[model samples]
Target: MAHQLDKSVPIPLYYQLKELILNDIKDGTLQVGDAIPVEKELSAIYGISRTTVRQAVAELVQEGWLYRVKSKGTFVKAPKIEQSFIQALGSFNDQIRDLGMTPRTEVLELEVIDVPGFVSDKLNIPLGSKVIYLHRRRFADNEPIVMVKTYLPYNKCKFVIERDFVKESLYPVLGESLETQIRKIRRYIEAVESEKYDFDYLNMEKGKAVQRFISIGFNYRDEPIEYSIARYRGDKNSFEIIITAT
Candidate 1:
């Protein structure tokens, strides 16, 4: 592990150590599952106290960047997956796997409800038409990362609700069941402060910053098939768009 620590810097020693470890992992100097030196060894090498080393290691473990096994020692964790906004065709499951974290979903609620005017407009369906409402919470390594609300026409995809959504991605199921192709998607994003309901499900503090995304997915026939609204934790997420000029 390589890190440049300035003793004169105002930052605390533990935080400095934490950043060094994190940077080493991010830069590929430390590979996943690579064992780190024990606390006493690290302290001796850095000329710091064991308490400082322990604090840095503890924080890293909490953030999923490191794992500690009893009597085994600390090991670097796999990096989080990166999702490119440049490609509209992307899967959240694949993104999570790239990040070296397990992606788990909890289907909080699912039911058929009358389409509201906003949803009807987005889905291009008649108002009051039956729609399948899917409410779910997505987790990354057991940390709640997003809350999603998705709507689909009930008549077209009634069987979709019967499948296990917890382990499935909605896009693939829609394709298989409806014989539909997700030709394109439109997305919008904005920053918002967390609300009471967000706090309840996401276990986030009210007034915390969050990123809200609205997506409309269309089929090959240029017909809208899915409308979804999702909120992600600002602290844990970043969206990148790649632009190429011709």
Candidate 2:
């Protein structure tokens, strides 16, 4: 691979190297499965330290732009397609089905418990009220995707928490069993770093970037019914929203 460096530019050397490599990949100068240069060679060619080269490569690998084979070298990876949040209202299973992928869920924990203050407030219930806590590890094509924690009023849906959530969608259960229809939702998104619990559940590095979505769902009668907090891997996932003016 041939690269040109601008030593006079104010940009950091590692970032410059990263950009050059990314551009080559994007412009088809480097095709998928092409082996990238080794760190020492890259450093020598760029007149920078091997540490800088490694840093750049590490970032690319984490972002899914590259993959490293155990005994071989690093190779270019196919880019992931971004998901459009503006499309429609659907469950994770439904969304993945629309994309022609199989969505699976691993039930991590499901239990009825006393609602905490925050959860109670979000669900518009009194503190210490009974709520079903549903925790799941969501996957796409068997690859871990996101971790979700959902809270629902236990009194409204008595037997839902006892069912196998890994094989069912909570939305359907709520609609069929409790006769609750989610008519509207409020959501917020923010960037967060993986913490200890996330490391255990999502198999992510402790400090890696994640996308946090906090949502509250309402029923037809204008009553809050569901509160959920979900975290998705930033490197592997993205969301898009469309705005329409009145």
Candidate 3:
């Protein structure tokens, strides 16, 4: 195959080929879900070995730029949504919309339940205290991205049980209904194996990992207002933390 790929340059052939496909996708030459050229065709186009083409394609697949279907060729994939926590404290709806994607939320469960010991401690409430437990699955562009379980002191937050989470976000509701503003949020995150909720709500397969976030929101009075457990599909989401120098 005659090619214009610079063989005299020090850059590897496979990486160059990978960049070529990435540029094509960036410039709208390849739309999402469009199948990329086969290894043989790509090899011919680049005058590279089949192995080089395979390497480039495999890297793209691993990096979430492409996906492979058994008995079918590789296709372009939607990019992961970046969830920036530190840079902005926007609601999921606002954040997803800023990224040019539609945001949707489904309330899976909403009821008052006895607070478990762990949740009680987190909320600094009594162990036998009742809480408004709200479970939700959030989506971006109709794709399931996260499942969250939120616990709020029932005595104060019972109003939330009646609000329509599908058409609303909890944070805004809290600000409107509560007497004080949510002044701070403490969050802990870890990578953990997916559970039943992940498999059921997130469409994750067995053995897949999820990013678990435990967040405690505090009011202006320094009292805990909400404790939430959110699990995000690692492949569909990425967290970005911005660091600024003082």
**Steric clash pairs (candidate 1):** 80-99, 81-99
For candidate 2, the 10 contiguous residues with the lowest summed lDDT are: 80-89
Best by lDDT: 3
| Residue 192 shift from truth in candidate 2, angstroms | 0.6
Backbone clashes, candidate 2: 0
Q: Which pairs of residues collide in candidate 2?
A: none
In terms of lDDT, model 2 sits at 0.84
Candidate 1 per-residue C-alpha lDDT over 75-129 given as tens digits, one digit per residue, 9 for 90 to 100: 9875433456436576777778777788999999999899988899898889869
- Please report, in order, the local distance difference test score of every candidate based on alpha carbons: 0.84, 0.84, 0.88
Evaluated at residue 47, the lDDT of candidate 1 is: 81
- Candidate 2 Cα outliers beyond 4 Å, as residue runs: 1-64, 67-74, 177-179
Point out the higher-scoring one by TM-score: 1 or 3. 3
**lDDT tens digits by residue: candidate 3, 97-212:** 98999999999899999998899999889988899999999999999999889999988787888899999988898998555356788899899998897888899998988999
Residue pairs in collision within model 3: none
For TM-score, the strongest prediction is: 3
**lDDT, model 3, position 77:** 96
RMSD of 1: 6.9
